[model samples]
Target: MQILDTYLTKAIANNDTRIPWGSLKYLIGEVMYGGQAIDNFDRRVLRTYMNEYMGDFIFDTFQPFYFHHSPDVSYYIPTTQVDAQQQGLPMKEMCLGISR
Candidate 1:
């Protein structure tokens, strides 16, 4: 999540929410996970995952993050997971949702 940290840092420094999403998307999809993908399908999956999980919508604190959602249950990050130790405050564990 270093990329996210860097983006947050810059956002704070500039007092702007407008991230260079095009470049960030490419960096996440190609530079980060692309090399680990075994094949074209694998690469596509990585790209899709990045598109869904990484976006400007994340800046909206009013909205809750839903990694997975259904009528029965929804997975979300807990507010208590915020880590102050990082350069840009990041959750210690984003997938810690056990219920609700």
Candidate 2:
């Protein structure tokens, strides 16, 4: 979280905080699936940090496919300094399985 937050801080300072959503998606997948990247916990942890701290600005920018799943792009647009409670939006998540 520190590493990502550091990058985020720098990005925000530079007025270029928008990050490809696929990167995050892959990160989550890697965490859950392992191998593709550094596996950590499930997507929930990431979602808590990103979606909570910074507003999830979703877009159509698709990242290069390789990690084993597809996800929409989300710009880290922090509208408030506090972690806003997830309201209104239904709680839904996409789960993928390892390919044979």
Candidate 3:
């Protein structure tokens, strides 16, 4: 959880919505869960946690992230958890409000 918190901070600071394959693999496969040697099952569980829970609380722009993996790589991108209408404010409104 702490590792994910740290990475979340970095991701927010970097405004990075697209996390690469290597980073996710390292975080979940090696660094997390007592650093135990993990297999496919562990990976799926971690991925699900990120998708279902972590996604709800991460950065506003990048909220609802999930692992998108292929045969060779894994990545995280924004999920379709909430529709655009449900978001806080539109980009235009936010920009206009910022001028105040």
The full ranking of all candidates by TM-score, starting with the best, is: 1, 3, 2
Local accuracy of candidate 3 as per-residue lDDT tens digits, 13-86:
99887754456555765577534536778667656554543433445564433333457543444346445524
lDDT of each: 0.68, 0.43, 0.53
TM-score, cand. 1 = 0.52
Model 2 scores a TM of: 0.29
Error of 1 at 67 (Å): 1.5
Give one digit per residue, the lDDT tens place, for model 2 in 8-64.
Answer: 577788997567455555444444433433435544555544453332333224532
TM-score of 3: 0.34
lDDT of 1 by residue, 1-100 (tens): 6975786688789988677777788877887767888999988877777787788776568997767677865555556644532334334444433232
Highest lDDT: give the candidate number: 1
Better of 2 and 3 by lDDT: 3
Candidate 3 accuracy as lDDT: 0.53
The per-residue C-alpha lDDT of model 2 at residue 64 equals 25
